[model samples]
Every structure is written in C-alpha cells, then in structure tokens.
Target: MIRPDSFVPSARLAPSADALLFIFQEGRLLLREDGTLPQGHVEDFSVDLVNPLGMLDGRPVFGARLVGEVPTGFMLRPLRGVYGTLSEDLFGLAGYAMQIVEWDRTHRFCGACATPTVRSERETSKVCPNCGLTAYPRVAPVVMVLVTRGEGRDRELLLARGPHFAPGMYSALAGFVEPSETLEHACHREVREEVGVEITGLRYRFSQPWPFPHSLMIAFTAEYAGGDLALQPEEIEDAGWYRVGSLPTLPPPFSIARRLIETVAQGE
Candidate 1:
C-alpha cells in the first residue's frame, strides 16, 4: 500500500530545474525510454493544464495533460502497463495524477447549476463561483474479498473471474460501496449477490489505490459460512473453491485482490 503522507501535498507548483512532471494524454502516461518520470522544466511541451501533486524527494512535482507531440524516447503507455516498471512511490503519484486530470477535465462546470468552476487556490478542489459548490479528486471505494475454507496446506480459497477478466484469470470477489452502506455490508452483499453464499469472520486487510478510474480497493478475508456455488451470470463468469497449487491465473501481484489471496493461500 502507498503511504498517504509520503509527501506534503501542495496546491501550487512552479516548474524548475528539480521539478518532476507526470504528463498524460488521453489517460495514457508519458514515461521515458528507461521507464522514469520526466524531470525539470517542461517548456517544450504544450500542456492543457498543470496541477500540483505535492513535493517528492525535496523536488516539486506537477501533473498535466499533453497537447503537443509526444517527446522523443518517451512512450505514452497506459498506467497499468507501467505497474512493475516504476517505483511504488512513482506509481502512486501516477495514479494521483491520472485522477486529478480526470477530475479537472470532467468537472469544468458545476453539476448542480451548470456554471463554470474554478480551481481552488487554497487546496485541491474546484469551486463553482456561483453556487459555492466544490469538487475534489474523489475515489470510489470498492471491497475485494477472498473467501477461504478449511485450513493450512489443504486450505481452499473461493475465487472467481469477471466477464472482463483475462483468459483463465481469477481473483477475489469485489464490488463498489453503495450509498448508505458500510464496508462490511458491501463486502457480504457482494459475495452473496455474486456467488449465492455467506461469509463470516470478515477480516479486514490492507487496501490499494487502483486508478483505472480512481477506485480504492479495500481487501478482506472471510470464512465461508454457507451456501453452494450459484454464480450470478451477469456478475460472475465462474466461481469455485480451489487449493493453492491448483489456483488459476490470479490478479497481478500489485493489486489488493492478489495480496488478499496470497495472504491465505501462500503455497504455489
């Protein structure tokens, strides 16, 4: 998990000799040939907007979207493609940058009154000058639960694959938290709705900031309480209990879902 206080977040920035920039174009990040963030002043590139992303390693960092041609030796790749190539801190910053760009782009106008919104000078938010409405970079919280049964080397884990998952890949069950619901409720409801089962001893695990479009995955472990495999066709393509060595292709290690699985099913 990325530390939330890794750096002192600032609402302003001024590119200089030591500044680092995380620039994106159409949600794709710009990484250099050696897989690193661009550093120093970015005067050569035409940027649509630049937002401060706090201070890192005593260097000012900024996030922006490119309007100019891609710089030579710098490839525009999806953030997912740069997962293992960049440092954990850099990946976190990239996720932050992606979310900021999306928030700024989509919230140019007020949702309630349709008035143009202005970036807050005091913090990371946008304000509608007319209605006092404010918008911040928001993260939708999702719960990922890995259900387990039995114990030790013979321990079995309940895993499933979504319709959109890669071939033969399976991961923990997950769903978004709905309004007026607790995280625990969301977790149990998701498991029951998707697999027609109940889980107990819901143990809280770590979380990961997944930025496909700004979601915080809260992972957990639970004991199988009851019910049989009755997969919800619309949500789950397949689901079943499997031993560690027989597990299918799981989610990438960087994801919280993967961590939850590895925490219990450590072998193989």
Candidate 2:
C-alpha cells in the first residue's frame, strides 16, 4: 500500500512507520472503488485477524481482516476479481496473506495438547507452550488431469461438468492428494473415481496455487486407456470426450485447469 520503490523487505520484520497493509472484510480484500489496494490509514478499524505477509520493495506487508462495517472511502472485493487490476507480485502477496490470516485465526490453540500456542518469531507457525509442538500452515495438494486420445485433428479431450459448475461449462478431472499417496496415483484415482476411466502416460505439467482457502494444483496430461464414461452422479453431472472444434464452456483463463486444456488443445 505504501508503494515504496526501494527498501529491503522480509516476512517477519518489525513493523515500521511506513509499513503497507492489506485489509480484508469477511473473505474479500479491502480496496479502493477503482480496484487498487488500499493505502489509507486503518488505525480506526477493528481487526479480527492480522499477520505478516512478508515484504514488498522494502516495506513490511501485513494482512488483516476488519471487523464490522466497511470503512468510509474503501470497498471490499473478492481477491479473484482483482487479479489483473493488481501487479503480479502484489496479487501473489494478497493470496499468501489470506492463507496466513486464516491459519493464524484458526490455529489459536494446539490440536494435540489443548494449550495456547505462541507465535514463532522466525517462522510463520504456532508453537505450543505445553507440548512444544509447532503447527504450520497447511497447503493441500490437488491433482488435475486432462485425459486425451487420438492425434492431430482427430484428438479429443475428456471434460466433465461438476455439480456446481456453470451450466454448459466443463473442465479437467481433479481431486485432492490423500496421505501417503503419490501425485501419479492421485491423478489416476481422481480420473477413475470421477469418470470411471483408466488412463496412461501421466505427463506432469505445471502447477498453480489456488488460495480460495489454500490449494496447490498439480496438472498432468494422461492418455485414455480403458473404462466407460460413468459419471459419479453426485460429483460429476455430465462428461464426454470433446474434440477441439466442438468444445463446451471452459474454466476462467486464470485457472490452471483452463491453461492445461489450452496447452493440449492448442488452437482451442
């Protein structure tokens, strides 16, 4: 918010007079009406949760969730909606801030010993005083698969519509990675469970951090091997293999699912 062009910044620095703030209400970030980060004084607002979000251009960046009504000149907006409106670095900082704020708000006590936890000075974690156990923020990893078969113009993609997806929209098959399971195994399991299909050639692609709460999406491309198109009625409403020329409504461009489809489908 300070927009300092120079200075060394760190995640856990002593707050300075020129510190920048990222405020949120409910789960939405506080911004100006034109969708820029708020740079105004917030000493008047009551905060529900607050935590450091590292540094930007030499200023300590802190995140806070405001209590009660929205402040006078500022507005509350969903973090996703202001993607392009913010600088790439600032956008990432905002998402990370949200996760930290939520982690601090929820992990006030140790889960094991029921003792109040103390903040770690050098790390973003809570240390239990009684048990000496440390609790760090959790990032759940999810696997996304874009199943394909055939080649060239004959190539097709397996897309499915979730129960809550917009009407006529479809995307890649995805599921969270369970404990002790590998990414490859999660990919196969998600596709099989969601659509009852077997796949091969599990090619790992890029990943994206979706911080609605906290989720790391690892994407891959798999070739259809076997199994019929059996939708998991509750999770998936409809599914089918789609060719490039005839595709349904896809996800937003910001999502890894959409990027994964585009990487394979190319011209689509």
Q: Look at candidate 2 and tell me the lDDT of residue 113.
A: 91
Worst 10 residues of 2 by lDDT: 1-10
TM-score of 1: 0.94
lDDT scores of the candidates, listed in order: 0.86, 0.82
Off by over 4 Å in 2: 1-11, 16-18, 40-44
Question: Per model, how many backbone clashes are there?
Answer: 0, 2
Q: Scored by Cα lDDT, where does model 2 land?
A: 0.82
The best candidate by TM-score is 1
Pairs with backbone N, CA or C atoms under 3 Å apart (clashes), candidate 2: 7-58, 11-54
Candidate RMSDs in order: 1.8, 3.2
TM-score of each: 0.94, 0.91
Tens digits of per-residue lDDT, candidate 1, 1-268, equal 3634667788877768878888999889998888888887866567877788788868888888998788788889888788888877788788888888888888999999999999998998999999999998889999998899887778899999999999999998999999999999999999999999999999897888887898999988899999989999999999999997688898887788777787777732
What is the C-alpha lDDT profile of model 2 across 39-129, one tens digit per residue?
5334545776667666677667778888888867778888887778887668777777788788887889999998988888877789999
